[model samples]
Every structure is written in C-alpha cells, then in structure tokens.
Target: MNAWKMPVAWMSMVALLVGGCNKDEQNVAPTDDNEAITTATLTLVNKAVPTDTVRATIENLNTTADFSKATLNLKANTTYTGTIGLLDKTKTPVVDATEEIREKVNEHLFVYTYSATSGSQNALIVTITDKDTNPAPGPYPVGLSTDMQTGAAGTGTLNVVLRHQPNVKDGTPNPGSSDLDTSFPVVIQ
Candidate 1:
C-alpha cells in the first residue's frame, strides 16, 4: 500500500507541473492589420445590480431605477440621458416619466450633462460620480467617464468599476447589508 501511494503521489505531482505550464498567456497583441481602427464611433453600455436580487421593502420607484442604457459617446464626447419610462402594458409614462427627471430619472439611455472645461485638463474625459446635490432631488444619474476618466486621459477605452451606495438601514433584501456602499459595474462607449 505504501509503495503504491508513493507512485500515485509522484504521478499527481508530474501532472500538476505539466498542467501549470499550459496556463494561458496574458495581454496578447494583434498579429495583423486585420484589426483596423474602427472608424464608426461606437458606444458600449452596461449596468448591473450589486446584489443578486433586490429587497421587497424597496419602493417601486427605487426598484425601477436602472443604469442599463446610460451611455457616453467616445467619439462625439457627449452624454445623453436615459430612462425606463413606464406605461401600463401600453408603454406610456405611468406618472409623468415623460417629462425629464432631475436626479429622479428612470430611463437608462445615456450619460449626464457635464460642464465642459477648457484648460490643460484632460479634455476627452468621461465622469461617473455621485452626490446628494442635483437641480431636484431623487436618484440623480452619475457620470462614469466624465472629468479625465473618459477616453481623453489616454486610451479612450476605460473599463468601469462599480462600488455600491450605502443605504443599509432602510431594509432591502440582500445577503450583504444594503447601502449607498453597495454598487455594481457600468460602462460607456
């Protein structure tokens, strides 16, 4: 039994060494011009919840808050506002979602309205910041690539990072405590 176990362990070690050498390489470079620069300006947008599911205690209004369509044009350097307008099954603003909302937006269409600064500052910036301040109060959209974060800093390609907001005491359903502290990933074009 002892001799057999030694052979088995030695074989396992050799397999592990061989498998480790097969690991994939990182940061592969393009081999050909087939990857020409895409001339047509494109926008890549995405949004996700920090938790797997939302709590039942949340207000319908809060549940409807989506960052799905929020987008920023990398080429145009512009932000467009988005919404998740509700209509009965007929598709109309149930309340007044038709009107532009302040921080209380529903659509996930585009990015936020930003102040254009003309200094030595990095121009091609995208921003995604949060504040309790807005023209009105509710759930204002945040900037993701605004400021210098936009493709302007250097490579227009910026991978987004999501950190949740902390509102834990209000009582929502999540394994992790809910708060503005809990956020998810979103990106711009």
Candidate 2:
C-alpha cells in the first residue's frame, strides 16, 4: 500500500468508526427536557441568631433601614452561613456578611459552590423580603441599597468551577478551597 494512502485510509476508518458514537453528557440550559440547567445545592449551617434585634445589637446598629439602604434579595426559604458581604462606594467590602444567608430583596450573599459543568452556567436569582412585618425602605438593591458596581441584585451569573467534594480526580487528592470567589455578575433588575 502507498504510505500516504495507507495513513489516509486509517484516518478515514477512525472517523467513520467514531463519528457514530453518541456520548450523552450534561447539557445545561433553560429547557423543558428537565436536564437542561445544571445546578448544585448546598445547605450551610447558620451561626447567627435569627432575631433582628440580636443581629442589630451585635452589629451595634438598629435593624432599621434608617438612612442606610436596606439590604434585599435575601431568600428566607433557604438558610445560608458565613459573612455575606457588601462593597462600599470605593468598591471595598464594607459590611461583612455575618448571617448564614439572609432572606430579603436586594441583598448580596455568598454561594458555597454550584455544580456547573464546564461551558454551562446558571443565572443566580436572589430574593430578599421583609423578614419582619415592617419591611425596610425602597430604592434597595437594583435601585435601593447597592448600585451596579456593588452587585447585581436578585440575579447573577454562577459558572461551574469544578466538581463537588474531595476535589480529586482519578483517585488523586484535589487541591485547595480557593475557588470560593468563583462567581460572575448579573444586571440590576
């Protein structure tokens, strides 16, 4: 067989052999098929008291929105932990998140980690409501408290960083927890 022709034939055979292989994989998206959007859910334990008064006292401030804009988009349904923070005018994180995960509209929170396969991402939507009967003032997150530079209220981008737990591959120990800052932004609503 001619050398070039033999290699060409081998390449053609491999293509024909592998072309028909259909490997079903993760397809993240907004779809009706149910497998469209990929997601990772984690429930962190809360170390802060649920009482607004206690929280305010600890912070040395009134729970009242006062002149300060009230934080929002804190979904009450899900419990979260760690310092949920907000950056200041100079783009510095001023208020460190003390609650597990706050529930209200217009608040920025932390995500432990989300399961997003590479190339797939999820839109993060946060819902903060009036934890008490007395809801705080308006112009909250998207318009009220924080501005575009601070954070996108209600919705943001959650790109999958890596697989969950152990951070290992093929039975090897995975690296570190530096992926905590993994996140993207959403437009103000």
Candidate 3:
C-alpha cells in the first residue's frame, strides 16, 4: 500500500507541474483577414474654394485591371482637404470597407508616399489630420482623411497604402502587411 501511494503522489506532482507550465494564452493577438478592397477613391476638395474638387480612383478588383492607373490633377502650391474611401464591389450593395477600417482603426494604418516623375521622393506633403484611439491603450492616426498640399508645378506619383497591423502599429509604415496599395498620377499644374 505504501509503494502504491508514493508512486501515485509522484505522478500527481508531475501532472501538476506540467499543467501549470502549459501556455493557454498566446502573446500575440489572433490575425483577422483583410477586407477585399475592389476600389479606392480619393476625393480632394479645394480648401479655399469648396466647390472645386478632384477625384482619383482605382477600380477593377475582380480582374487583371486591379492595378489600373488613376490621375489626380491639382493646382501647384495648393492645399486640399482629402477623404479616402474603400469599397468591396463583390457584394450586392458595395461593402463600405472604410467603415470596417474605422472599426479596427487601431489595427490598421494608411501610408501615403509621394515621388516626382523625375524620381524625387516626398514631392507632396500629406498629413493625416484625424486620429483614432486603439483598444490596446494608445492613439494613432488612421489615414481615411487627410490634408494634402502640392509642393510645386510638377508631375509625380502619390502612393496610398493601407496596412493591416494587428498588434504592432506604431505610427510609421514599418510593421504590417499592405491591405491596399495604389498609385495615382499626380499633376500639380
């Protein structure tokens, strides 16, 4: 009886030790699938003249034309108020992907890169004017809307990239997978 009791106690202790060491929760958050974005529209309205507006869009999510070209014509050295919207055209009523991005604002980010036709970077000044609070306890700017300013009369490319950054978004465009990336031919005339 004593031998049996000793063996049983040893097995119980071993089980307890192993169970206590089990990793029940993961350090990283579970990944969520990115929304299927079929179209990206950027509407820029002149700040001085409310009626003057220009739009650039990228369409064709279901075909090879996904990387279609868009042109945005603007005045040189002008300031424009811009709003960006994303849509999923596969649904009966095109799903407003911008709303989904707003819901997960903390986990998503939009990065705007500008380059001149002559290959000079930072040709345009793009500043995200709005910000959203994160669930993990911080605030970061989500690029659904922005204030854009043209530097000078030049041709360039404005690249908009939406990044899906679950647990690792720290403002910069360094730590996530690109959800939507599109380039628009920008002419500041």
Candidate 4:
C-alpha cells in the first residue's frame, strides 16, 4: 500500500477501536439515584409481648431535624422485631422512601451503629433481618427489617444510615454514599 494510504488505514483502525470501546459506555446502566428522605420512623415490637411496641420518628430530616419523638424505650434482655419506614415528604403525594429502597434493595443498604451514652458499651445489638435480591455471591443484608436485642439497662444512641450502594453492595456499609444518616436516642430499662 502507498505510504500515505497506510497511515490513513492505521488512523481508521485506531478510530474504530476507540469507537468500539465506547459501546460498553453507551450500554452501561445508570446508577440508582438517592431518595430524598424527610422522615425516618423505627417501630419495634417485643418478641415475648407483641402488644408492647416502641416507636421513634425523626422528621424534617432534610432541613431542620425534629428529633423530639426520636427515642426508643426498651426493656433490657429483650428481643424486638424492628422495621424502618422512610418517607419523602417533599413530594406532592408524599413518597414512601422505604418502598423505593425495597424496590432497589440490591442497590441500597441500611447500616445501624450503636454508641452507649450510659451503661454497657454494647447496649443494643441490631441484626438486619432482610436480604437483597443480589445474585450468587450476594443476597446481602438490607436493614429495612431488623432484630434488635438489648444487652443491659442503658442509655445510648442508634445511628441509622441508609447507603446507596448501586452495584457495589457486598453486605458492607463502606461501598456507597449515604442517602440518610440520623440518630435516635435509646433508653433500655
């Protein structure tokens, strides 16, 4: 082939290779968008006594947080079945953020961290009872539902963090950006 034509052919091949590499970028799925959360409610029902229920709510989370009702009063040495309800009050009809999180369970995770203000260091133990729909290596934990067990009579803080993991959730809280991070006071008697 002629010298100039050969150079043109090489340039064309390089362009084709670059164009082919961008195909995957075009086919790549968009990551899940984080939900706007305005309210977070945690309801716990005693395992032994179902009638005994403790509810805590944190409202106006995106702006001025109203933590007045955000307190969990529990009985020590008791296990409670817990569920978290998240809401986006900014919407016209009000969106249930919890349902959205459930719909994208594989892309979302809730991390519960407890710190004792008084009494035992490990005052509350929280185990996520719900799992995501991630395949094979997954079925990772989703904290929408949890089993909370109290250790001793103590006052502590329960920090609830909702992470938007997208394609990186591996049952750990480190992979994603926090969609919601709030704390609720806990009093175990």
Candidate 5:
C-alpha cells in the first residue's frame, strides 16, 4: 500500500472500532431516583367525624423544619385514617412519588414515631392497616397509608420516616436508606 493509503486505512479502522464500541444501553440498568423528595404530606381523615381533616405538610425536603408553617392538630380520643403522599415538587406540575413507592412497596416502608410528653403518655399509635404486595415474594406492609389513633389532649411532635429497604425489610425500622425524615408539630385537643 502507498504511504497516504496506509494512513487513510488506519483512520478508517480507528473509526470503525470507536463506532462499534458504542455503549449497549440495553444492558445498562435504568436508575430509579433514590433522592429528590421535595415534599411529604401526611393527611388524616377522621373516621368518626367524617368532616374533620388534619394535614401536615413538610415542605423543603432538603432543609430544616418550619413547624409554624406545617403542623397536625387532631381531636383527642379519635381514630384517623392516615394517608401519606410523597411528591417531587421540583417538577413542572409536581410528580407524585407515592405511586413509584407503591410500585416498589416490598422495598419501601414508612415509619411513624412520636415523642412522649407529660400530658399525653401514649400520644399516638400507628398501625399499618393498608398494604401493597406486588413484584412478588411480597405481602409486605407498605405504610403509605395507615391508621393513627390519638390517646389524649397533648402537644408533641410526630416524626415520619420513609425508608428504602430492598430485600432486607424484616418489618423493622432498621436496614435502609432514609428517603424522607421529617417531623411535624402535633396537638390534640
């Protein structure tokens, strides 16, 4: 081959090799977002009263709490059917992350913990009444919705935590990365 022809052949071979080395997107696993939770709203509807509702929204998922802005106040000695809604408010119209969580219920769990005060000994109790069991090997309790009961009239803080525990959820608060950890000031009267 001529000297100029040799260089042209070498360039053509290099181009062919580089073009053939394109990444196989089929083999590349698509990633689900583990973060970017912008809002968490906990809604409680009174089963007895029917008209009463309590909503606690924790905005600014990336910052400190603004208790004055978002709080939950409920009547004492009441049973409230609690529903938690997670959202990625950074989107154009705000996307609901709860559904994505429901799709991965076996790997997700919501935990509700309350701080005890002098007036309200057992201030709050949370029961995982509803569950989502799919993507099989399932029957896991996904606490996107729950039952909440208030003991007595008191003031406390309700902390809600959503954990992503894939394949290691033994019905405990341990073993997972916290998708959202937020608290709301609670008053029962």
Candidate 6:
C-alpha cells in the first residue's frame, strides 16, 4: 500500500508540471505582421525656400519596382523638411499605409542609411523629426517626418528601412523585422 501511494504521488507531480508548461505557452502573446507597402514617397521642401521642393516616389515595391522617380535632386549645403508617405496599391481604392503606421506609431521605426557613391565626398544626412507617444524614458522616433540636410555637391545611395517593432521598440532598428528596405539615388547639386 505504501509503494502504491508513492507511485501515484509522483505521477500527479509530473502531470502538474506538464500542465503548467502548457498554460505558459497559451499565455504568450502573438506578434504583429509586417505591413504591405507597395509605394513609398519622400517629399522634401526647402526650409529656407519652401518653393524649392524635391519629391521622389518608388512604386511597385512588392513586385517589379519602378524607380524612375526615386532620384532625389537636392541642393547642396541646404536643409529640407521631409515627409514620407506609404501606400498599399494592391487595395482597390489604394490604402494609405502611412496612416496605419501613424495609428500604431509606437510599433514602427524608419531607419535611414547612406552610402556615398564612388568618388563622391558627401552623403545625405537624415534626422527623424517625429516621435512616438510612448511614456517616460520612451517617446521614440517614428521617422515619418524628418529634417534632411545636404552636405555638399555629391552623389550617394540612401537606404530607407522600416522596422516593425511591436511592443519592443527601444529607439533602435535592431529590435524588429524589417517591413520595407529600399534605396534611392541621391544627387545633391
């Protein structure tokens, strides 16, 4: 009778352990999916002269990308107020992905990287001017709007990457998966 009781107790403990592990698995939250972006447009207005504007649009990003207008013609040694617009053209009436990103501002981050072309001395400098509505020790960059400054007359490739951070945004691009990564030709005249 004593041996039988010991065996029953051991089995009950194992069952409880397995059940607890299953409960933890069920309590884990699901991650959000990446946004579908078919087009990305960057509009820059000269800070000193609003009339001097530069616009670059890259369409069909998910399929055969059209980069005809992806060339940015900026003035050298100038500052421009820039805004980015994203779109999902696959939708019937065209869905504005920029609004969706704005709605979940805390979960998205845009990272910009520039590489000067061969023999070019200067590269584009992009500073994100928008912030997410996170609380203290928070309020990270959203990158929908930015201040772009040109150094000198040069050419470079500007890479724009949109990261889907969800609840893990820490003001860095290393926290999440990339939703969009594209490069535009930059020419500062």
The numbered model that scores best in lDDT is 4
| Candidate 6: Cα lDDT at 9 | 96
Worst 10 residues of 6 by lDDT: 116-125
Error of 5 at 66 (Å): 3.5
lDDT of candidate 4 over 52-121, digit per residue (tens)? 9999999999899999999999999999999999999998999999989889999998999999999998
Ranking by TM-score: 4, 6, 5, 3, 1, 2
Going through the candidates in the order shown, the clash numbers are 41, 28, 0, 0, 0, 0
Give the candidate order by descending lDDT: 4, 6, 3, 5, 1, 2
User: Which portions of model 1 show Cα errors greater than 4 Å?
Assistant: 1-123, 128-156, 168-189
Please identify model 2 stretches exceeding 4 Å from their true place: 1-4, 22-53, 56-175, 178-189
TM-score (all chains, Cα) for each model: 0.20, 0.20, 0.77, 0.83, 0.81, 0.81
Please report how far candidate 4 places residue 132 from its true position, in Å. 0.8
The lowest-lDDT stretch of 10 consecutive residues in candidate 5 is: 131-140
Compare candidates 5 and 6 on lDDT and give the better one. 6
Mark the regions of model 3 whose C-alpha exceeds 4 Å error after superposition. 1-32, 66-69, 118-122, 135-137
List model 6 lDDT by residue over 1-189, tens digit each: 699999999999999999998885755586439999999999999999999989999999999999999999988889999999999999899989999999999999999888888435445788999999988778999999999988878888889999999989999999989999999899887
Summed over model 2, clashes come to: 28
Assess candidate 1 and give its lDDT: 0.30
Tens digit per residue, CA lDDT, model 3, 20-79: 878575578864477788888899999999899998888975455443446888887789
Which has the greatest TM-score?
Answer: 4
Query: lDDT per residue, candidate 5, 1-189, as tens digits?
Result: 899999999999999888788754356787764756888888999999878988888787866645555788888899999999888877888888998887778788888898865466587888887665644555667788888999878988888888888878766779888888888888888
Residue 168 lDDT in candidate 5: 81
lDDT of 1 by residue, 1-189 (tens): 699899999999999999888776576886431111111112233223222211111123234534343333332343322222221222332333223222322222223223333222343444434333334343444332223333332222222222223332111122222112112222223
